[model samples]
Target: MNHQGWGAPPDDKGATPFAYPEQPVGGFPGAAPGVPFGSEPGMPQPWNVTDSFAFAWNRIKADPGTIIGTMLLGYFISNLPSTIARFIPSDEPSDETSLIVTIVLALLGGLFSTFMMGGMTLFTLNVARGSFYRLNDIFQGGPFFLSILGANLLIGLGVMFGTMLLIVPGIIIALGLCLTTLIIVDRRCGAIEALQQSWRLMNGHKLNVFLWWLMAAVVSLVGILACCIGTIVTAPLLQIAFAFVYLKISGQTTADSVGA
Candidate 1:
């Protein structure tokens, strides 16, 4: 009646159960499971301007498909309002009404940009962590998506309001808070948590972060110069690369950022 394999008995003295050790669930070895994966855990990764430039280059090479698609989509959407506004003619309304319409249109445009940015951030984080993600995953509506969009809008408004005070301060604030979207999207943090976390992680690396921001700005300028066509290819790439930079600087592995 013994069912044990040859050379072993089920209840023999000093016998150990035949069981395979569980594989690490979410992350790589030496890191906690059920978190996002890529960088070493528990240590804050530092990124400076140099890292930003390097990240940009890396992004261009890593996922060109996403980069190009996001860029093109952004360009087309951004220009649509302006094109429509042009056809409306300036003489159609009182000056105040026209101004209101213009402002509303601008707000709409800003919202569109925020949506695109949020989607791009998600995609970028996915790529950086070496996770498989589909384009539809970016657009799938969810609480996370709504949170990201709200956060982006708030941040964008802050930047705009700050700029009204002084251009330089606004630029600094914008850069300081640039990673908020990624933080929110990757960590599923609330609006305020993402903002605070971004500030905390960025404490010593502002200069380096600015450098990467500058590179992205430069690439963006190139897109502008190409009559917006260049963005069709660069937007998604830069976004994912930015995510990669966040991973490197934060030292967060894929599992740490994204749960299993």
Candidate 2:
């Protein structure tokens, strides 16, 4: 599956014909292939953080409608379990019943969250690439859907189990695995492979990623303070920022063709 849009001809007789564009830092195609693409080694690229935030902001500015629509969808999906549980006739249910309900709701939320992440990643990639996208893009499921969902499930489970051991460890693991959804969408990798790949990319960059995430969290808290209406704007910004982060850390460009 050529998802990068490199325009390489299809393989014949089991040949793998696609090649990653040689993108070296400070220069286009002819620079040394192994050199880091856009910054000095060991020095964090300015765009790595700023560009993501900028792109996210751009999307929000350009298409407030789509941003709000997608975010509402996300909120609904995330809160579905609680919504359903509210109607269930549980007047002072026993501890066991409450535990079961909580577990079920958590599981449902996790599953929906994975699908939403995958779909949102695809939508952002499309928008970044200058392709026409619609609100429905947030729900499109393709061959890669299950793989992406599975990867998210594994990551969610890891976070949950890790939390059982210690809360801080779980948060760290969750952040470390943050890129798995994007990896699955971008690389067409299986669940385990996506998790492994995310782990690798995040290995030395955990602190940086955490800082960025914290920044986003702070911004989001401010938005929440504005009576939740700010989420319509903040959600899109965060998504686009995430798309930017996906591009930087994974060396992917939305300009690249999906399934190239």
> Candidate 1: worst 10 consecutive residues by lDDT?
1-10
Could you tell me the TM-score of candidate 1? 0.65
Top lDDT prediction, candidate number: 2
lDDT for each residue of candidate 2 in 1-260, tens digit (9 for 90 to 100) = 43332221232413422222323334433222233223221332334566667767766677778766776776687678778866666657576786688779877876666656666676775565445567766664343456766665677789999999999999889878888776665555566766776787777778778888888998899899999878777877787787667666665444322321
Top of the candidates by TM-score: 2
Worst 10 residues of 2 by lDDT: 4-13
**Segments of candidate 2 deviating more than 4 angstroms:** 1-46, 95-109, 157-172, 254-260
Tens digits of per-residue lDDT for model 1, 1-260: 22221122122322423211222534422333334432223566654555544655565566566655655555576467766666555764677777787878877866665555555565556556655555644442232444566666677898999999999878777877777777655554556666766777776667776777777888889977999777665566566567766776666654224442
TM-score of 2: 0.68
TM-score of each: 0.65, 0.68
Residue pairs of candidate 2 with colliding backbone atoms = 2-259, 2-260, 3-259, 3-260, 4-257, 5-257, 5-260, 25-37
